[model samples]
Target: MTSPTDPAARQLLAQGRLEVEGRLVDASNVTLYCALELDGLSGHAVYKPVSGERPLWDFPHGTLAGREVATYLLSEASGLGSVPPTALREGPLGVGMVQLWVDTTDDELVDVRPPAEVPDGWRVVLHAHDRLGEPAVLTHADHPGVRDLAILDIIANNTDRKGGHVLAGTDGRVYGVDHGICLHSEPKLRTVLWGWIGEPLPSDAVEKLRALPEKIYGSLGEELSAHLNGVEIGAVVERAEKLLSTGVFPEPGDDWRAIPWPLF
Candidate 1:
């Protein structure tokens, strides 16, 4: 199978024939690895149906697919382009989200090392002990792309930013996925990218935050309203405003668990 061009991929995701090839095992919710065909073009995509969503105490039931699309819209509007093109469409399972699959064949691991052994240029988030009771530290590469991801997570109010969610594309760019639990009305920003907490927001990130409110009210807000409630949309705008006002990365709060379970 050949990779589709950007425009063709977008068209396929938005309006294509989704054929479920198999299930992605061990996911918290039902996820399918599928083939998307449109106008003789074929490519791979991930499908997650609303009917398959597991109930969550914190989020409204069956809204995960919408949130996934919302994140893609927000990414495009914010000009971050870190999220892959995604759309809400009807698949074999039902109305679900279909996102163009990212190529991870050449991806590299974001290394985790003990604090004492960590090399230069790696940012440490916290210290802990391994299963064998040896000291270990959670770390991510201190790069601009990772920093951009940290900013994106903050704006999205992502509550499940696991380390595995960060992917490095073969094109030498980083991407984020699995945004079903993001953009909550409450402050639920749990993530592993706390490398720059309490630091000034990069100028580009700050500029994006300042312009996000405007972007939201336009097409992005309209698209999100279909999946998110008024309160949640308001909260998203509020979060953007707050970030712009503070002009700094936020520290993990003591009140809530700031890390996702099973860190990877």
Candidate 2:
């Protein structure tokens, strides 16, 4: 099968036959690991049935599957983040989100380590004491893709960018997943990728952000309307514009939580 980033992989995700292999027990909602086949091509994917979603007080308007697909669409349109090939479709359980699975490597991107033992080139995010009274620091690699994902989270208004959601794939790409709690028309952007706060946006990122508003107002807007409300769509454009005007990474807002709990 082709790499999940390829267009063919997206088509396969949108139109495929799935066989559930197991469940991801740690997920708050039902997450099934499945083996999927389409037109003689085979691959693995994660399927989340809408029927299994646990309602949240804050995000009570739509199914989590919609948010997942919407986030993927935004990432695709902006070319800022590496989101897997995701689609909403009928699965073995019911209608849900099906995303091509990424085979990740043992790469440690975001991590908590003893301050003295932190990698030489890693950017430190926070300095705190570990549970055992040991001095630990939160840090991440100064990688271009990781920074792109951080900026993507800002535009998408991602509310839950956990450390574990950042993956280093075997294909030599960085991916951000589990975007069920994103694109809210609110300023709730919790994430672990805040090491570049106050830094100027990369030249390439500035160009992409400038290009995003157009797509979000045109073809991308039509596609996103299926999952996001009009206000939510407008918020995305506004977020991009704000970032472009500022031309720098933002610090966490005081109105909401900054980083996800249990970072890893």
Candidate 3:
């Protein structure tokens, strides 16, 4: 079967040593933070190998995709669906590896520690936030940032946008993560932003989508296109145009709507 732990796993193992350092995440898949050796290079990062054994606890549905899911979400956020990261060459144990990377330059929202404890052992992850902060009030109807997220979710076919998934960076920008169960052939879209349903879409939001096709294709299109089919991309464009034409909050069909759960 084509699993996330397929060729990549073999490649990773061949390039590095696998020392299971125990569980890092006890959610759906029981992610084990492991030490790996990439040739002579080595570092510590979360390793989620696939197994048939199911967890006893009830994790939210579609939580088991692990790093594959994380990678997809990162692609959506960067506007590039498959941007590559600096490969970790095995050097030493307990350092030089970070599996799920937000921006290496920005303060990430997925770090799992108390604030005072600076993220260490991994260089890129040093800036990550252990916990996601509060959501800003949706102050205006013409917020381009919010609209960008809406378009992003639509393209990715996201089913969940838990408040926790909406990361408020220490910097004044917003970031989103966690996209394991997205971009499927199915229409499993679900989100908690129903209040905007049927509301008038802001004119600015429409303009943004109009320009996005030509604008984003130069940089973001290449990566995303690698993962999504042409029909999917066309669908994204079609929905974006429809949203633009309406110039109002849309009462989208079940396939296009969002899930009703908040991560907080």
Listed in order, each prediction's TM-score against the native is 0.94, 0.98, 0.49
Candidate of highest TM-score: 2
- Which has the better lDDT: candidate 1, or candidate 2? 2
lDDT of 1 by residue, 1-264 (tens): 434226677887888788899998978999999988888888899999988998888896338999998888888788653887889988898999888888864544355677788867888898898888889999887877778888888888999988888888765778889999998898999989998888898888878878888878887788888888888888888988888888888888888999887787
Kindly report which residue pairs in candidate 2 clash with one another: none
C-alpha lDDT score of every prediction, in listed order: 0.83, 0.92, 0.45
Clashes of each: 0, 0, 23
What is candidate 3's local distance difference test score? 0.45
Clashing pairs in 1: none
Compose the digit string of candidate 3's lDDT tens values, residues 101-204: 22223444333344344344211111223235622222112234444555566555566755445544333445455444455435655643333556676555
Comparing 1 and 3 on lDDT, the stronger one: 1
Best by lDDT: 2
lDDT of 1: 0.83
Off by over 4 Å in 2: none
Instruction: Give per-residue CA lDDT, model 2, range 142-218, as digits (tens).
Output: 98889999999999999898889999989888999999999999899999999999999999999999999899889
